[model samples]
Target: MPAQSWKLISHFWGLKAPHFESQFVIVASSFSSFLYLGACYGYFAKRERNKIGKIQS
Candidate 1:
């Protein structure tokens, strides 16, 4: 019985996996880009703050 269920599950995935994979790729790339941009912004902002502090002292 378990084997039969596993076969059914695999068959369903075989039909649908490509569509889900494409969606996952699109989502993952967008997420990574956002993460990279946020890191760059934070780094630049910290550097700018340090420069301001130096000018004040």
Candidate 2:
């Protein structure tokens, strides 16, 4: 995932050297998107597991 994002970021840099701010924004946004997804998955999984344990008990 990191490699893929780096590839995208590098590609943006290579193609748009003149638009430095835009490239940074793209990279930051892409990275944050991944981080948010990971956090969401973790929260959901933990909540589901807790529910299952309570039901089993």
Candidate 3:
């Protein structure tokens, strides 16, 4: 997953400079993935909390 995203990001920004682009892609891809994963986790976490609260009430 990470590797594929890295490749995708690199291929995107890497058009100008392949060497420098690798590092940028690494950071960008990891950050983007983390952000998305965090968002999904947060959404599900809230849903779970609501469900539990309703059940308990």
Candidate 4:
């Protein structure tokens, strides 16, 4: 194996390894936040249904 090939392999693995953890955490948090907001909006809208404006047919 050439020196360049070894360096390329190491750098590729290094870049990918940390991203797995960070990406999972970021994505999970964002999805949870979105779900929380959606639930809150759904609950509020359900309770305030009469107060909200009606749509025309």
Q: Provide the TM-score for each candidate, comma-separated.
A: 0.65, 0.55, 0.70, 0.55
Q: Which ten contiguous residues of candidate 2 have the minimum total lDDT?
A: 1-10
Best model per lDDT: 3
lDDT of 2 by residue, 1-57 (tens): 456776677677758776776677667777787898889999999999999999999
The per-residue C-alpha lDDT of model 4 at residue 10 equals 52
Highest TM-score, which number? 3
lDDT by residue (17-52, candidate 1, tens digit) is: 887765665565556667888899999999999999
Task: Mark the regions of model 2 whose C-alpha exceeds 4 Å error after superposition.
Answer: 1-21
What's the true lDDT of residue 43 in model 4? 90
In candidate 3, position 38 carries an lDDT of 92
TM-score of 2: 0.55
* Candidate 3: C-alpha lDDT: 0.80
> lDDT for every model?
0.70, 0.79, 0.80, 0.64
Candidate 4: the clashing residue pairs are none
Model 1 CA deviation exceeding 4 Å by range: 1-17
lDDT, residue 51, model 3: 100
Worst 10 residues of 3 by lDDT: 1-10
lDDT of 4 at 19: 68
In candidate 3, the residue pairs with backbone N, CA or C atoms under 3 Å apart (3 or more residues apart, or in different chains) clash, namely none
Better of 1 and 2 by TM-score: 1
